[model samples]
Target: MDVIYVIDILGTFAFAISGALVASKKEFDLFGVIILAFVTAVGGGMLRDILINSHPINWIGDLNYIYTILTAVVCTFLFKSKIAPLRKTFFLFDTIGISVFTLLGLQKGLSLNLPAIVAIIMGMVSAVFGGVIRDVLSREVPLIFKKEIYASACLTGGLIYLLMKQIGVNENVNFIISAIVIITIRTVSVIYKLQLPKIKDDIFTRNQ
Candidate 1:
């Protein structure tokens, strides 16, 4: 199997587990957990593919995606107590998921002959939109909307990947370096409680 394909599958599983974790926190039943898992695993990818006009979609053409999601959901449900306490582990998987998806989306966009700016946006969308959907479903504010450096990490990584590519870096090496950059940024931001400054609500209501 291609390395990118493998990374994509692993990323899917990671996202699925992340979604299941959130569902468990919300005390969702089995069906709801599975639904959330599936959506979180493929929601962003599906949207990205749709935007790019990829035929048959991604997960729809690959049954492995479904199986991967089911496995993640089952494991999460069975080990909810043990897994819930492992916040770091969950964060690690989530970071990996976003990192891999970002690269995949960027590559896909480039392959479609999209401009670098559009590709970068696609990468960011692929990395975070699933979590956005998941949060909306869970009735919580989306992480991207929060002060945390979530989508920005993906955007940073995507830019680095493009730069490395332009400089003739090996594809695999570029992917590894870019993914590490994203993961490190996210980890450090969480540890340091780093966040983007929020706009004051008064600014929006000033004219009103």
Candidate 2:
């Protein structure tokens, strides 16, 4: 398998694990967990593919995606207790997945010769939409709604990758650098519990 393809499958499975955890927390049935896993694994890429007209979608043309998600979900379920204690490690995998998918999205957009703006948007979409779906399924407001810099990190990585290409840097080095930037930002944020301040609710503050 191509290196990129292998990364894509690993990314898919890691996100599936995230979704399965949420489903289990919600007391969802087996079928619901499967749906959650599949959606969290492929929803973002599918959305990006559709937007870019990358047709037939991703998981559809590749049954391996299904098998990968299934395996991830079952294994996650069997070891849920152990896995719960390793949230940070799983998040490392999730961040890697985000970086890989963002790069792939930018590549796909640029393959069509899309403008830099569009490519960045595609990259952000590819990275975060799956998390959005996962949050909604778990009955939580999606993180992107309040915006604590998750999508910003993806866009920053995409823009950096594009800048390096424009400057004629080695493509492989550019990829490594961009992915590192993303993972670093995500890791720091998680370690520090960093989040943008929420706008305080004040419905009672009326000028009557």
- Which candidate achieves the best lDDT against the true structure? 1
lDDT per residue, candidate 1, 1-208, as tens digits?
Answer: 2876787787888889888888888999999899899889998888888998987887898999999999988888678677768777667777887899998899989999999999999999888888888999999988679778988899999999999999999988999999999999988998998998777777659678
Worst 10 residues of 2 by lDDT: 199-208
How many clashing pairs per prediction, in order?
0, 0
lDDT of 2 by residue, 87-140 (tens): 777777788889989998898899988999999899889889988988887788
- Once fitted onto the true fold, the runs of candidate 2 whose alpha carbons sit more than 4 angstroms away are 197-208
After TM-score superposition, what is the CA distance of residue 97 in candidate 2 from its true location, in Å? 1.0
